[model samples]
Target chain A: MKRLNKTLYSVSLLAMALALSACSHDDDDNEISEVAPPQPVTYTYQIKVTNLTSGQPASPIAVALHNADMPLWTIGESASDGLALLAESGDNSEFLANTALLATASAEQPTLPGESMEVSVSIEDNAASTLTVAAMLGNTNDAFTGFTAMDLSQLEVGETSTRVSVAYDAGTEENTESAMSVPGPAGGGEGPSEGREAHDFVSMHPGIVSAEGGLSSSVLTSDHRFDNPVLRISVMRME
Target chain B: MLRFNSKGFRKTVLATALFASAGLAHSADLEVTVQNLTQGIYFTPILISAHSNDASLFELGETASVELQAMAEGGDISGLATATEALSANNIANPAEGLLGPAMSTTASVTTDEGNDVLSIVAMMLPTNDGFIGLDNWAIPEAPGTYTIYLNAYDAGTEANDEIRGSGAPGEAGLPVPPPLEDVVGNNGVGVTATVANDSVHIHPGNIGDDDATGGVSDVDNTVQRWLNPVAKVTVVVSE
Candidate 1:
């Protein structure tokens, strides 16, 4: 009876090996028949921005994903023409078309003070490892805020990074604080003009010295004054 | 009771050196850069120093030292330089040579000696009574990388911020009118105040001036000279 049991077990093992070979043969046949390209992997990011200022309304927020070779704007350097247009006029059309961008998204309307906006951008089969966000302070001459060239590669799926940004003077336009040159609701004047300030390098903004603060020619009031950390931004990897 | 003496300090330093030579110390060569971020404010001759952990240039909520008072009031860094030298600090005085104008920058190189692991920077802001930019005792990182720091404006609290034109001497009561600022600053002004409310080092209240450049409550220009916090940016690059 024991000899019979051992023979039966050997037969069952041989049968299992034969069945595995048959399954492998079927998989090879299927691979040969199906010749379509592999599906592309999609990477999606969700960006939420909040205006922290008491009075300064932010322009349409511009978000872009790009490689680390370039930055939207640099400190102690001249502002690009695209950056100058957005900072002075609150327009993002030109900035969105930056040559280095792999994917871009922007808010359609102004982000009022104490308001938050979320934008999502997606790209397929490309490694855009850096993120940049920017918006103009509508009441000032050319003051803007947001971070640039933030590394997004380390963030895994469903992870988020939060950062607070300080105001920057674009230096493309002087801080005259006059209604004729400011294009915001407080000013209701013309957009960016033809000339740049003598000190035409990006730097930290000196803040608005409104008419109530002793700039008699300024159209802005004391309510429009703002300080550092005007914007809070968070970036999350959705997929 | 705890007693302190120079001999005891020297012995402690010698022991630290012996232990550091056994492979625990991190000495570095550093490149320091300071930039005036204000649109219209000028920085007086700056004093940059790297000293031991116990040494400091100034502390907030404390009375200003006489040497610090001279530098904050008159941009005279000689006294502070001498004081830090006694502490065996690596000092760089006035890398800009003269006043560092708005939107300008200067650089200095310092190779720190053993155990000098902290940095401090100080400079007077022109066209104000005793306003200064200060970086108080920041630790030098052990890693080899670049670091950035933002500095705020502080009032030395040794003199009143009388916005009118006056002497730059310690205990005086007016803003210094340098040759470059002579044309821009207004004259024949009454004065902002003759007294200081806070006698300790504190954040400076921004300047206030009227539209009347020829005659106003203050001599400084409100629109041009006013600045927010973080009036200066410092960049430090450390390498072995």
Candidate 2:
């Protein structure tokens, strides 16, 4: 049998005993009378994201709070049209507006190379237990970075959750670094097109193979390249 | 203990029981999730382990053990797993089911037994011959909280990091490109190097790739395949 060690068993048993004792003490207080609910408290969440990529300046971040049942994207699944649009074009307006959110906000501006930006969102009554922040790396074809569905339940009032997130390919387009496809200043504002020919299933980004790197046909140079965890995010809950 | 009278003996036993209960509170039930923090590399299946205070997966500046070499070069956890099992260690092998790619994450739940209180994780980073992401033995906290750790890349001392495509078998040179990585990685490129500079496990120097896909200083794409340290993230939630 797969069993816990004796010490763990004893420890778990003691914890369970204590919890049971607490529940027993509360059994008598199960009153049927209902009272008026208190006014909802608005909790402000401040988000600060730093662009960790050497060259890529991240797009303005799209921040959202949703219930546990919601996830921005999942591996092996096709990205939502909104996600595809954001990943491909570096415009997060659609993605932000599309999320059925408990709360939502966006960074005021893009985070430049080695620069940081801040954004804030507020929820009524601490209703959201999960938060997700996403932004595109403007230099890539369809690469985006952020955390999806991170649980914020344990963050006490004024407490912060800090994390570094890796980049992801939306799989909505082939990583063709042509001037007509990339939307950054290096590529001159080329936005999303009707051509969506990539794998179409979200996966770990297989980074940009630049012209100075190893891809023979790529138009991007080493200055347009980047590495992992392109963004650092810190979220503080202020009630 | 027997010198006490009946009443005193009963009191002594009760005191022992209370002491035992206090010891139990020190152990934690932890659920661990490891996320690959790279944008271009892949991690060979991981070996998550929990051992005593004295044990480690691989230490910096130390020569790589045969077990460590096997794990870092070929993504084979069996040798390391065997070594850990002999020490009565807690282990979770191949938690990602297969290669965990760049910017990908996998979760493994492990309830560390009381004696095996420190956690470690190791796996080879693909597209490189012997680079690996390693978590040196970290002590699990006694308090119930969620702790997150970011891991750095390491070079296994066993093989020359000739960033070319070849075999997944142990004792062989070059990297093993899985089916998923075939399209992303280049082919017909010259090898990176033929010699091992450092024979001890050390910090991995990031890759330097050239522009030519067919004949270059490295087969890896510099923009696509290079990475900085802290290439993996581990989150542990200790349930009270």
Candidate 3:
């Protein structure tokens, strides 16, 4: 049986950027611009994500490539409705629909435990860019794992930057672990709930209290529990 | 606080850039902030220190040092402080004065002497047997920039998590129920267990709490006392 121990309850986003800032030099493209404002060069990146959890399958990943100045999520801030939708129900439709997005791509299927998924996204005519990938932990109330707006300009062509991502609680909903409250496969797979949340500010996820432990009312079992560093992402610039 | 740096500051930036490339940091001036991120869990007095690379506050998969054990079991930082002082380390103890309640934060500033290049932190969690949040010996960067680190809850593995009323002394059974915890923690738990299975420092499994108030399997509230990983968030701003 899994020990399903107590982990920290601090929300954190660890984004490690091994950057090489070689921006697009427009010397050659200047000749083409004389005819038409320079045909936009496509900056494409292949994002590979590996689910590292024991049981939780990562929901369809929502990959957003943008150049925003701020991070997609913060430790002490409240979750946006887009994040709430992805974290609570394993849905990325709302998150992808977020404004200020430069380009977006998503995985068509769930990435199960110990599995990897590759999705590519490209943006045209952009000089600066960052990457954000989000997916639900498909077995909890609001656990999601992904990277936040990581600067993509640091990666030279054919270079890959990697980081091991940890799970985060949306903090929009309480982690009650009730069968009705959980929208994961362990519960009913009902998806994100449309309701008021408990904690307004985001933090690290305190772990699940399953019936296997002592929360007799908890809908999660021992397998539903997890630890940190749940997802590993490798981002490489292709074009 | 975002400090906008530019070309006019190229000298320091270049020096820092070189040091960063070599993955080394010399003496640094730092403004540090730590936040307790839980909704219901409280952190006792905190300890933050900047020391040499050879020293560390806690080591994973190792036996608990007496100093770490005392802090984990009873929220004591005196021993650790004295030990750190012996190393001529730059350390701050209890910036919050007392218990840092849920979601509360504290800040401290320190200037590191040459060769003191690592940062470490510790704070016991209330209503737990031997759980404490820890940041063990992270290398302080040479560059002047803002860095954020998340702390994980660690079990000192010195005592059994009986989940009942008990003493706070090291090697003693039970938790130290301060006035604040007394109001929230229930009484007369039959004791969860008498022996600890893992007697070495490890990640805490968490409190096995029940909803019972007067009589129950455990004294801690299942909803309130349990926590997940990353009990604390530490932000450090390095300056020239």
Candidate 4:
């Protein structure tokens, strides 16, 4: 994780320079300059994510390359509508489209328990020093897990960074774990609900209370309860 | 030209070395601010210690020593303070004087003794039997800068988390409900369990709060008392 964070830091410094040029205002606006600015060195990163749960299968992962100015998620705040859509319905299209994401990629299929999937994403024509990876646990209501705006610039060529990500509540939906809201096979593939019953602020997941354990109203079983560090993610700079 | 340049470089190097040595000879005064980030949990009296590198308050996966048990179970720092005093450490006890509520914060400052180069802080979280927020032996960097650290909740491994209101003395079986926490916590809990599965210092498994505040599986308020791993934020500023 530390190595990846360092690589991201270096990448972000270069990205910052590019972002400044992209948004810089010149004193002379009389002539639109046709000269193209120097494009930042593009780097390709391959991220491999593994679902470490015993039974919970993860939805498709959302891998993005962006600058440090963008933070995909933060605790104690309300979830973005884009994030809400992804967490509740296991879709990444809206998340990628809504955020000014430099580049985005996703797994082709749902990653099952103890399963791993690798997706490669590249930033073109711009310097991007940070990377954010997000994915949802399809069994829960709105629990998504991933890193946010992590520095990727310090990574040298051919080096990799790894992190164990804990689950985070999106605060967009409650953990009803009912048959009508969950998209996992345990809930028979229910998609996003028209309305939510979860908390409104993003926070650390309090974990599931399955019916087998205590919460009598929960439709979840013992298989639904999970611990921390649910996902092991590795980001390797390929270029 | 080469001789003159070498002579000037040597003089500059000597001056730099002298300045660095003089800086190291001085002590540091630090301003510490601690915030309880959890919305539902309350922190008892806080104990911030600046001790030597030789001592540590707690270690993960280890059994709680008698002194650690007293602090974790009852929020008492007298034992740990005595231990640090034996080593001539700088200590700050009970900056908040009493329970610090959720989203509240407390600040304190301390001037470190020359050799007390490490800093650590601890506080017991109420509504739990033996859980405490701790910043174990962190190396205080000599550089003059501000540093922030997040603290995790730890289990003392001394008693079972029966989730009922009980005594705060070491080796006691249930959680202690102080006057400030009595109204906040619920009652008529059937008791979560009577088992201490992992008898070593470990990350707290989190509270098992129920929707029912008056009578349920747990005496803790489900909406108000449960927390994630990180419970406290510590910011330290090292002054020259």
Candidate 5:
């Protein structure tokens, strides 16, 4: 079995247990019930994504919560301009600013391979509250991975769920595998260069074949070969 | 966890919703769907199987079995198929019938035989020395729902990823360029590495390509052929 990166899970569990246990000692039920329509409380969530890949660093994550039916990206569909930017350049600026979100958050730096970090957002957590998180696999062209519109309404005050995500091709750029095309350290070239050539439909990523394999023009090596489940994501309701 | 909260707004409400736990305790029918999640990599024939707890196709940190090496090195799973069949594993072989192109998908239904409580899957990634995507010893929840799992790239550690043209036969040094791949992959000038650093099954480090399509260090296109982890997505829907 794989050893789970569950420190964040444990902390959320402990906090929830304490919150629930606190009620057991109180006889203030009558007092609590006497209060009139209570004010809506703020709900906060913490999402920690660990880079499970051996060499791929994760672009800083872009996170959003919405009470509306908003999908950040869909398989078989072309990417929105904002999403395309995030996927190709590892820049979450435009994605985080989209108007559909009730709350949003982003990471300031890239999450290096074998490292884990947290990016969080808080919202009303009301009906229709759903989460969308996205991050680019920094070493590739237009490949991003994350989940969108995961229902958050049902999770209790203290519960955590971990999900593994596979890479997705934004279909915004052609996979060129050249030193001047990839924006990561492997390519060290331009990011999100103009002139798109793909059909522009999102789909499962087709992997890169570095110079070590067959693409003699590629700047990457065997060390850059990766598989699915690039990210191990844990979402916890913090408050 | 159900709680009765009287926080000033209640007539009595269950403010929390429960997400169904994706586990079970019995036999099931599964509709397994797998999608190639990369832009440049192709998947060879896929092998999906259900077996007992004692059986696993591969384990991390372990040496590659001869059968596994055959698939990783040459895109052949016949040997492993025979070995698993002898163990009473229920399998669906080559759901796509041939090479699954980039970003494509294949679906198949598998009914678990008695005592076959675990599921596993594997497929070779084309244009590589010994790279494959696989799932090993995943416990099928006795209960039924849609379960999604992602697969990572793995190296068979059997050959040096020289990135040059070579045979797919066991103990070969370079990748096998089939007719379809022959057009996409570049011709070699030099190889990448001469040795395998970790001579055991392990996570793939990823690919590195250059720009010289005709002649350079590799035949791969770094802009077109590179990728990240999570090369595939597997969705298993267990009958309710």
Candidate 6:
């Protein structure tokens, strides 16, 4: 009886192998009939930015996915006109229209202090290995906080990466903190005036010297001052 | 028995060779760029070192070593460089050769020796009592790639931030005003503080410069000399 059981088991294994081969053969026939151009895959990313400041409000967050060939802004280099517009005016229209961007998205409204906003961007058929996110600190003169050319190539689907950002001076305009130069609620002044009047190169912001901090001409008060890591940004690959 | 001994010796030699090759594989060539991110603050000569993971330049919440104090207070990197060299560290001292001005960048190349898998950088910020930009024992990645790190200012805990013109010696009371900064920094100011409150390395409280260039409470200029955190940006490119 044991010998008979072993023979029967071997016979069943052979039959199963034959059945699997037959299924593969059917799949091959179907594949040949359906062979066509490959469909493009869409890669989508969800970006969430949280304002961690006490008083400073963030401009509408602008996010871009692109190759690593160019960064939105480089330290010690002059800010592009597009970046200057966004940093000084909180408008991202020109920035989003850059030719190098693979995909772009922006928050519909400014993110208030201690609040969070999420924006999604999608690209098809190409890999976006670099990501750039930026926003203006609405109360300052040409002060913006965000990161540029952050590597997103290693990010996998359903994976998230979080980072805190420091403030950068666009250097396109002086940090006058005067009511006429600041465009935020504190000053309600005109934004993005003509010319690169300051150092004309991007650098870390020296922070605000409010009226309380001895800038007698400053329209800002102590409440408008902030420190580093002003914005907490998180990016997740959704598809 | 003789044949067995010979075979054992051959195996030992092969293992030794493998270990030697592994050590060679761990070494890396690094091109490092240090950019003063501050709009106004200047960095003294920077010291970049590639050492073992066991060593560090400065530790937070701990008393700074004498070498660290000298570098932080006086922009003297010789002491720290000597200390690290004793540990077989590969060091590039004074990469900027002098004060690195605001928004300026300097690059240095170093080929790390065996076991030197971590990098440390330190530079004193001008117009501060004992504040320094520090990157403590950042592990160098084995894979070839570019890495960016932002360095924050630290208080060496060895002097008072008087914001006055004083000696740069250890246990000093004020900042070292170099010739270039003489015109920008203020003078004849009462010191900000007289005591070292922390007495241990910590994050800098930042400058409290009054706009009075000649007779404010502090000699530092609030608008021109004061800076926020992350005073420097370091870019490291790793190669074989």
User: For this target, which candidate reaches the highest TM-score against the unseen true structure?
Assistant: 1
- Which stretches in model 2 have alpha-carbon errors above 4 Å? A1-40, A46-54, A74-77, A107-109, A114-120, A126-130, A149-166, A201-209, A227-239, B1-45, B93-114, B143-150, B167-172, B176-187, B206-240
User: Tens digit of lDDT per residue, candidate 6, span A1-239?
Assistant: 34456877887799799989997998977856656688898888899999999889999999998889799998889999999999999998898899878889999999999999999988887665688999999999899989998888667678899999989999898887889889999999998889998879999899999988877678999889998889999999998
TM-score of predicted structure 1, chain A: 0.83
Task: Name the TM-score of candidate 4.
Answer: 0.75
The C-alpha RMSD of each candidate to the native structure, in angstroms, is: 11.1, 9.1, 9.2, 8.7, 10.1, 8.8
Best by lDDT: 6
> Candidate 5: which stretches are off by over 4 Å?
A1-62, A67-70, A75-77, A88-125, A135-147, A157-169, A174-195, A198-239, B1-26, B59-63, B171-173, B194-200
For residues B1-240, what per-residue lDDT tens digits would candidate 4 score against the true structure?
A: 764565466556646875343223224688888887665677888889988777888889999988889988888888988888888888888899898876577999998876677888888888898999999877776667899998999998888988888888998877888888778888888889899988899998888877677788888865446776667878999976
Writing each residue's lDDT as its tens digit, candidate 3 over B22-54 gives 434356799999998775688889999999878
**Model 1: residues >4 Å from true position, as ranges?**
A1-39, A125-128, B1-26
**DockQ of predicted model 3:** 0.24
Separate DockQ for every predicted complex: 0.28, 0.17, 0.24, 0.15, 0.27, 0.34
DockQ, structure candidate 2: 0.17
Tens digits of per-residue lDDT for model 5, A143-226: 888999999875665679889887788998876667787888888777686755786778877666666665656677777766
Query: What is candidate 1's CA lDDT for residue A148?
Result: 88
Spell out the clash pairs found in candidate 1.
none
How close to the true structure is residue B38 of candidate 1, measured as C-alpha lDDT? 84
What would you estimate as the lDDT of candidate 4?
A: 0.79
Top-DockQ structure, candidate number: 6
Local error of candidate 6 at residue B8 (angstroms): 19
